[model samples]
Target: MVQESFEFVVYMIHACATKWNRLPSFVYRKLAESGCIQKFLVPNYEILHTQSTDFVVSDIEEYLNVRKVAI
Candidate 1:
């Protein structure tokens, strides 16, 4: 991944962790297992990175929800 996208991934992982009251590692694992990192976040980085953190988090939540992934 490029530097910005990599950084964005890390930021999102931590953001999700905080919002979900989980550890960053756990969030990363959840996102990875659900393909959120690869299929959603990174692929949509150009647009997502421009949004508010809460907005992005909401988007992630929706994505996970549709996939039946609990936080």
Candidate 2:
């Protein structure tokens, strides 16, 4: 039962992020806690084996839009 519940929560996170097309920072934390998103993300191309293809969207405050907590 516990495993089933955890799977459901992960699915919800992907659904909300992919279906809705946007997610808040706090939501991302919950998703990570539920094993939904990456536990550790490398922002730069410092990892030689992997290629960084992510495009960051930052506003005037110079913060990743996805990392901003909605209050």
Candidate 3:
């Protein structure tokens, strides 16, 4: 089951945000805190303990900066 539309949306968003950088984190935190969005977003183990593709320390710092907070 390939999702071309979903992938296109993600890629377009990421590409446009590369210069802005903080957009993803804003989205991530909002999604992470919400039941519906979080279900489709990154999982807890990877977000908290692993530095895989999208959930790394740099990403955390970027996200914190957007919220004007730190971890």
Candidate 4:
């Protein structure tokens, strides 16, 4: 449940980024402080070799779907 909520927030962040071309600095800082920047967005590059904002959003969506199925 908690994970799902977190992923939803991450998805929203990426969705905003995709629309804006980049996340605002303040928003990015807040997300970084919350650890989402490191845990979800960063690790994706290590595993997939791509960290484009669109890819990040897709990754979060995929993760959320997988978690939903697990439930």
Candidate achieving the largest TM-score: 1
Worst 10 residues of 1 by lDDT: 12-21
* TM-score, candidate number 2: 0.33
Candidate 4, pairs of clashing residues: none
State the lDDT of candidate 1 residue by residue for 12-47, as single tens digits: 999989988999999999899999999998899999
Q: For residue 59, give model 4's deviation from the true position in Å.
A: 3.7
Q: Model 3: per-residue lDDT, tens digit, 1-71? A: 13543453354335434634658665444434543123332333333333343443445446446656532
Question: Residue 21: error of model 2 in Å?
Answer: 1.1
Report the lDDT tens digits of candidate 2 across residue range 1-71: 24544454344444445543666455566545543233222222134114322222212112323555331
By TM-score, the better pick of 2 and 3 is 2
Question: Which regions of candidate 3 are displaced past 4 Å?
Answer: 27-71
Clashes of each: 0, 0, 0, 0
lDDT of 4 at 53: 57
Weakest ten-residue segment in model 4 by summed lDDT: 62-71
- lDDT comparing candidate 2 with the true structure: 0.37
Model 4: per-residue Cα lDDT over 1-71, one tens digit each? 35644565555575756654765564455456655556665554445433465665566556545545210
Work out the TM-score per prediction.
Answer: 0.97, 0.33, 0.29, 0.36
How many Å off is the CA of 32 in candidate 4? 0.8
